[model samples]
Target: MRQHGLEAAISRRRFLALAGALGGAAALGGCGGDGGASSSKVTYWVPPNAELSRMQAYLADVKTGFQKAHSGTTLDNVVVPWEDALTKYTAAFSGGNPPDVTYQIIPWMNKWRSTGVLADFRTLDKGFTDTFLNGVNPDYVKAAEGPKGELLGLPYVGGYWVLALNEALWEKAGKPTLPKTYDDLIPFAQAMTFDKNGRKLGESGYDARNVETYGMCWAPSPPIQENYLWHYFWSFGSDYISADGMDVGFKDDAGRAALRHMKAMVDSGAVTPPNLYSDDVRWQAAVMSGKAAMAWSEGFTAEYAKQYPQLRIKVLEPPAGPGGQYIVGACGFLSVAAKARNRSGALDLVKYLVDDKPLQDFNKLILAKPVRQQPSNYYDGLDDPRMTTFMNEAAALSKYVKITRILPYQPQEYLVGKINDFLLGRQSMDAMIDEASKQIKQMAKAAK
Candidate 1:
């Protein structure tokens, strides 16, 4: 397996450092004014990296309505890159002039608390945390909790992963049915995999050298990469770590069996060889051009599929790996900086953003829906059926949020990339498993 390039890791750390270094910038920018006046102007930092455009629109609509209702205060929103959010956030704390509100993933709450960068919401509004979607998922909440068990971030959105199927390929393979259980999936994948000569199903004259369409196109990367492994690990009734993420769980037999099963997908040619960074364009080209059969993608992808009208696509829950278990992942939340200037305004923004009106607008504009209490009023005439489909699947499965651990910063990504390398013939499966287990243990030890 290839080691994560030094530059890749350094770039990430440097980004965080820069964010922390912003204390002087805020001071120089004159942003350290004493909490704005009796009526304050609050600054909120939204990650400016990729979602800048999407967040900009959401903030605009939210600010217009919020300012109209709350005459006492105003909102000043800034888009910070996810890469720079940590550093910039800490920098805000350095000058004691932090933005009134900020966005963050829940798991980092504990990490930030250790740095004394986060403020306790419990100290400000006792009922504020409870007003939001606290139980969206326990794992998610745990990710957002401080080491002291205080809530650090609020649940802003909910989504899950799904199998993206190219129906054209399915129909070509004699209308093969979508497998629901692990037992049904292997054979189905084998059937979907074929040679260019159209020789399939172990029939006569099968040509090994002329493999045509792949049964699956799976990547070993972040966001969606390790998803396959998690299903396998859990279906076999195993976990990556213990409840608190304090111990490694993959050292056991169930984990080994799960790893073996996943590796078989590559050995048997059921899925593509490991390509850590499988670009979206490559996936679209392969799936649309009929070179690949299926892809594992999130809910937002279905909406993007509309651009290719000629391709007949479908979405289904990923096949159960060992048991009839399915896991779903989602993203959404609005956080108030602990050192925020306009505490009242921050809380109000959280209320309105997660509330019905703006949440609905966000769902429309971004093409990604949220799990708010009230459904959006904007979808009455939206011609997109993908939204309803994604919502139905999300509603059916219980969302499982990622666990946030301090030491192995990007644990899931590391696990997936390493194991995937073995599956692609880059290393022995046993070696990969052992190495990953060791790394995870060291990470846990460091966290302690």
Candidate 2:
């Protein structure tokens, strides 16, 4: 809804103009000197993490191993917060000082490529390109492509949403058989929801306002909402945009049904109120504190379990909708800056990071699936069977996975915010759908 920061406040046109001006200035300044392809130093940027110590150790290992392998090269590792990464990257590029390589999301890759700030790895080392193309998942490759099919980035990790249940709460609710369909999930959720007085939904004298625990908890903000809602849209035979990318795809009966189902869950008082817990951390805290019985785990249950071993969390396939069972999947990518000083060194670092051993360790630490087809079996050794279950389910559901397209103008935050407004009863379902459709068409047409 409301624009968040400097990044969101700047209009696209104004931002581009500023970037072009600064870029030109940097170009006239000799592009910060030619470090050349075989330069001995490379700078890298990664997103911020809650487990600072663990992530620092991982980065240290990467730096040590890379320096050892390259023999005389230095690696400058930097941790950038996701909220500030886009802005920082833009400033860095404009100043001719961007990191040689950075971890980015598909949307960022698309955004930077449009601004000529991202490099096409296809134009880099052939050996690395060949290895990446032949080894990584085709779905991810597709997700990371530029408008003209250029390799904007290399996929590093992938994940999908799953149903995460609190085992203790499940047992308290009589351990009812897990829901297999959206229709079946309602009653199960009702069973898990209760008031301070111990009255569950549908029972006489139950007070929804005084509820102590909810059946489900999930953040309804921006990116998280978009990611979580896509699973429902796909399962209901709807999608965010049409295959041709010319229009909104979910404007029909399937879309309406999906929205209605979501609204019903909220109206049933079984889902955490979006207005109350608008933050992701608070939503996760609800599940962690045992105040919520279930949640839509966005591929983080393993990390959560590792952090909180006392809570028994179980991962289950998302409840199927009438159309089919599906999962909304996405990938994180590694991209080189277009003005990177050491292109060859950047490619080398990307290669080293995605190699089997390092990739396995990274994915294990984050509990993510590798971009490569031959995934590591480190999950098999986890003390929690749920981690193994998540991995196996992700692999099994690969066929049913739907990856969101990287659009020139990503309106995901606005679109999902409108959906939340509708969910919170601020607007009618028809108004929400119609307005969203109009917004998508207008943005898409403008981008074209």
Candidate 3:
């Protein structure tokens, strides 16, 4: 698994050094007056989007709106690549400054708090956190509470992972009934996996190498996918960490089974060998081109199937892992920096961005559906029946979705990263399990 930008493995020392350099360069660019503690200037950093030009235009528009609303304050917008955000942002701090407002994914969000860079963005508004308590999945609300009970940040935009399949292709293959439990998923996946000869694993002409399609590849894609696989670890009735978030849980029977199942997908020829950022694209392409029958994807899949309208896509509630049916979702947060010289401005912007009008508009700009209490922005894709189908299914499963509750760490480090090592033959599974357990216990101890 060659590093593809953020997911590529870099030693901790090297990663920190790189981030420090990036942060130093940005700080030298002037976080806008007095080293990012400016009284009248507020620095806002957002993760990079698919189209950077579109983001620039949107930020320009937002600048105008925010200035109009604030009268005298200035909002300086910064773009941080989403994938390596933690390191870069950490580097910014090392550079002697960080943005006043930053957008962060869930896993790293708490890591910030642990690092002392996180501000209680909710403290600015008395009822602000209340909005998130039940706005989306209630789990998000529950997850927002920090280990010490403080609200982490507002649950911004989010999506949940689910089981998706090409209905037409499935019917063509005899409409194999999907699994009801994790124990049953492997065979179903083996049936879906096929080679150049169009033979499933058990077929006479089946070939593992030179494959035409894969059964499951989600777990192999890292940095981008470790969190998704972490969801699987929980579903398999074992967590990556201990009850107090201080130790490894994978050495146990349940975790061992889940870890092995993930490895079996590769060993059994259910997925392609590790490739550099190829699995995600190839798996989707395979499904669309009738080479593969199923995939695990997020709710955003609404737009994916639309690209191949001739094909019919259907979704199933994720099969219950050893732990029972569970789903993992994530959110982008609008958080204020604790040491901001312009607290009032940062607070105002955070509140403004999450307001009904701003949130709805933000969602539209990103092609995401609005989850606000009231709708003011018209999301065109919301009208697509296919998107609606996906949304409805996601909404119905809200009861099972877990957001920020999972352990906040380099999910790649002790979890999927080590697992990848096992798959790559760089390490033995037993060694991976032992080392991951030891590292997790140390990390949890340090979190305290």
Q: Clash number for every model?
A: 12, 0, 1
Q: Which of candidates 1 and 2 reaches a greater TM-score?
A: 1
lDDT on C-alpha atoms for all candidate structures: 0.58, 0.70, 0.61
Residue-level lDDT of model 2, residues 119-144, one tens digit each, is 88888765668766785657778877
> What's model 1's overall lDDT?
0.58
Q: TM-scores of the models, in the given order?
A: 0.80, 0.80, 0.73
Candidate 2's displacement at residue 166, Å, is: 0.7
Task: Tell me which of candidates 2 and 3 scores higher on TM-score.
Answer: 2
lDDT of 3 by residue, 264-363 (tens): 7667666545562454555434555556666665443434556667766676777788687775554556776666668778878887787766776566
The sequence of per-residue lDDT tens digits that candidate 1 reaches over residues 1-448 is 1111111111233234444444323222334223433336766666531234455666776778888888867777676655545576666767777776666643444346566555566655768666554555665565566678776667565444456677878988887878886667666777887788887747688775677878777655554454446667777767766556755566678877777777666666666645523564454345555677776644434335576656666766656655446554444456666555666677777777766667666655544434442333434434456555544444445443332333435477677677667777788867876787788777778856
Using lDDT, give the best candidate's number.
2
Best by TM-score: 1
TM-score of 2: 0.80
Stretches of model 3 off by over 4 angstroms after superposition: 1-42, 71-74, 81-98, 106-111, 114-117, 136-147, 193-214, 260-286, 298-312, 367-399, 403-411, 417-432, 438-448
Better of 1 and 3 by TM-score: 1
Q: Candidate 2: deviation at residue 262, Å?
A: 1.7
